[model samples]
Target: MPWLISCSAGYQKATNTSLATTFSNAVERFQRSYAFPGITASYVLPDGTSHSAAAGWADVENGQPMTSESRMLAASIGKTFVAATMVSLAQERAIDLDAPLSTWLGQNNWFQRLPNHRSLTIRQLLSHTSGLPNHVYLPAFVETVSERWPEPGNPFTPETLVRFVLDAEALFPPGEQWAYTDTGYILIGLVIEAITGRTYYEEVNDRFLEPLGLNATSASNKRRLSGLAAGYAAADNPFDFPVKTTDENGVMFWNPALEWTGGGLISTSRDLAKWGAAIFGGQGVSEEILNTMLQSVPIGDDMPGTYYGLGISIFRSGPLSPVFGHGGWIPGYSSSLRHYAESGITIAFQVNSDRISHQSLSEIELCLARVVISSGEKTDCVP
Candidate 1:
């Protein structure tokens, strides 16, 4: 799969007409190529100009069109929200990042069951260095969930998820080698609940959504908000496969209680663009704390120029500029949120299909970057 390469040169502001046309065409190509049920994308320039484009069907069965306001599950992009919230909590002295998980969560049955429970720090959990076994990767866990799908009382609690991985061995010693684990963020959510005496969702709402006024973003499994785009999956696999509307496998069937802080966010590209500007542009955390959160560790040779920070991934590979954001994958949705620091531009896109490969998503982002760059000379666009 060849990716559309991006030029490293500085970007100039292009007319909204031209940018929107380019973006819309690119999105149409992406949709047709991957047979995505629908795709919604929005970009915010530093000067506050916003451009949005949507292609395909939000509800294929009903012939609904994808719109800028259509919401899609934001998968792991929720981790970036978790990371920002943690930074805010640390600043308020509500929780210490370096503190061991045992300090706040307490030594319950789950803690006692897992060795080295006391050695894992909040920082490690945020950075995926806690060596915790990812519950999603466990075959038994996946099978159990699949067996219970769409059934009453099938949702797994955060504690239950921790218990499922308690017997599994650690991937590495805490704070040693970097490894991405949804279990780490699950623990982080639990820690937040412990320290604040409120559910993780509540804290996120108060700290992030409320302050930023991002009304479109919320936990997927929680309340049913309006304008949510229906989710779908490819008929076969996502790679080099065709998508079918009847092949729908929406996240509505998944247990929201299980995904929690790991990847349960549902949001629109417009709201996510606002979130990217607020969180990455230093609206929530102080400069020092934000810098700390952005500091990343390499994940080894498999992913060159790719590093994992607290709840975020930093990509510096190829001629494309470095971006600070995260991608998300749930049952019936895929999302990508990116902030190009040099251009002061933030782009976010969400599709109803989860079958799209990460590489394909990256290319979508690259296409957006290419459009922004090819527009003309530099402007005062700073987010």
Candidate 2:
């Protein structure tokens, strides 16, 4: 496995001049508009350059200010990393994109136990058309597991998480209707582990993170990371439910095992934008892999132009702008990454509160798009 080496501390220091003005403006607006405790916004322009800003607090209890360096959970944004890993491996011929998963993961009795298990393919898993039930909705699993391990001391092994979903039945035939399911990504993560003979963390670290020089970000197993933001029900002060080390913090449970490839990684806005620049700038993966990752597959009619490609979502309304990337909500954290290929603009925002709506993310995106389109410049992504 080719691992990406973390950047040296000196190299990790980013020059602030390029993005200082736009980032500062975004932060000021975000602070005024929302009561979020902490928020981070980052932008990557077409030239593969990035700028970022951090506002509010990472830990309101300690009065700690949010820094551009503070790492927060990427939530479902980790899906892009998982998709990249799979595509890279597929390109290497280690995993087949079209072959049945059984070719890689032998037909365990568990497959015989589930309906239409043999029909599952690698593409279906990546695009989320595998018809697998959403594992995150399994009330018993989280409650049962938390009761056993209340504190954030433990992590879920890939095998353990797969076993938990073995009993889950498919929602439809493979490549049929679209359904959002964490179970699909969980299986993908397991496949990565089995094929590489390395843990998901190790594979991602080696294959993705290191190459991008995302030294400060990582796929964390621990509940709270150093220089990391703690999730809260409210993004700002007076957090109705703050995550305590002792118990499951209402909706803010920190389960790296549960998120896995679906939503586990920890990163800062700055590193996240760097990741966009790395992948889109054709650094590690081939052009074919990048194209494959961007091709959007129809989900269902209910959501117009809403397609799942590799790890991200594609939302297209008109020729003016077609956005690519995913939006994530894990308890107190809500994040969205929108990349406009035609404009060569990427906007990434992270909020440290749970109640922040997807509509808010969409609005933020619209605001940024207007600024970019009006200025008609490849210079800055103002949000």
| TM-score of each predicted structure versus truth | 0.89, 0.85
lDDT of 1: 0.76
Q: Candidate 2 — what's its lDDT?
A: 0.69
List the lowest-lDDT window of 10 residues for candidate 1: 238-247
Task: Please provide, for model 1 over 36-101, each residue's C-alpha lDDT reduced to its tens digit, 9 standing for 90 to 100.
Answer: 889988887777777778889888987889988888878899999888877778878756688777
Off by over 4 Å in 2: 1-19, 149-152, 234-254, 318-320, 372-383
lDDT of each: 0.76, 0.69
Return the top candidate by lDDT: 1
At residue 169, give the lDDT of candidate 1: 81
| RMSD per model, one decimal | 4.3, 8.2
Q: Flag clash pairs in model 1.
A: 46-382
